[model samples]
Target: MDFKNEKQGAFMVVVPAGRMDAVTAPEFEQECERLIQSGELKMVADMSALEYISSAGLRSILATAKKLKGQQGEIRFCGLEGMVEEVFSISGFSSMFPVFDTRDDAIKD
Candidate 1:
């Protein structure tokens, strides 16, 4: 996965492209950690560019959420489509966190 980040108001918008699987899951975690350490407590994950995701990716996201929770931080999602959206919905991730249509909508909260 190729991850990119942009700061928008109080949130960091995370864009992950390509595929997210076991090999790249750690990279995602590391990036989230780095963001957290940098004092970014609010995040919006824009998954529109992501073509694929696996259980490892889900685990990484869960782990990231835990990290943010302890610091009173939060993670939300936007631009989810195709199988990625299905996975989130089937796995009940949709209810676990806020899912928006765009970064702007997500950061509004």
Candidate 2:
């Protein structure tokens, strides 16, 4: 996966692209760790460019969410499309966190 980060006011908008399987999931987690450590706790995950995901990706997301919760931080998701969106919905992630149609919508709330 590829992570593109941008600063938008008080939040960091992260655009994750490509497949997020076992091999790339750790990279995703690592990136989130770096951002969190840098004090960018409020993050917006823009997944529109992402093509695929696996169970390992879900695990990575869970781990990140847990870590953020401990730090009183939060991660919101936006731009979900295709199979990635379906997986998140089926996996109950849609209800677990905030989901928005765009980065602006996420940051607005």
Per-residue alpha-carbon lDDT of candidate 1 for residues 1-109, written as tens digits (9 for 90 to 100): 6888899888999998889999998999999999999999999999999989999999999999999999999999999999999999999999999999877799895
lDDT value for model 2: 0.92
lDDT string for model 2 (24-84, tens) is: 9999999999999999989888999899999999999999999999999999999999899
List candidate 1 segments past 4 Å from native: none
Q: For each candidate, give its TM-score against the true structure.
A: 0.97, 0.97
| Model 2: CA > 4 A from native | none
Instruction: State each model's CA lDDT, in order.
Output: 0.93, 0.92
Q: What is the alpha-carbon RMSD of candidate 1 to the true structure?
A: 0.7
In model 2, the number of clashes is 0
Clashing pairs in 1: none
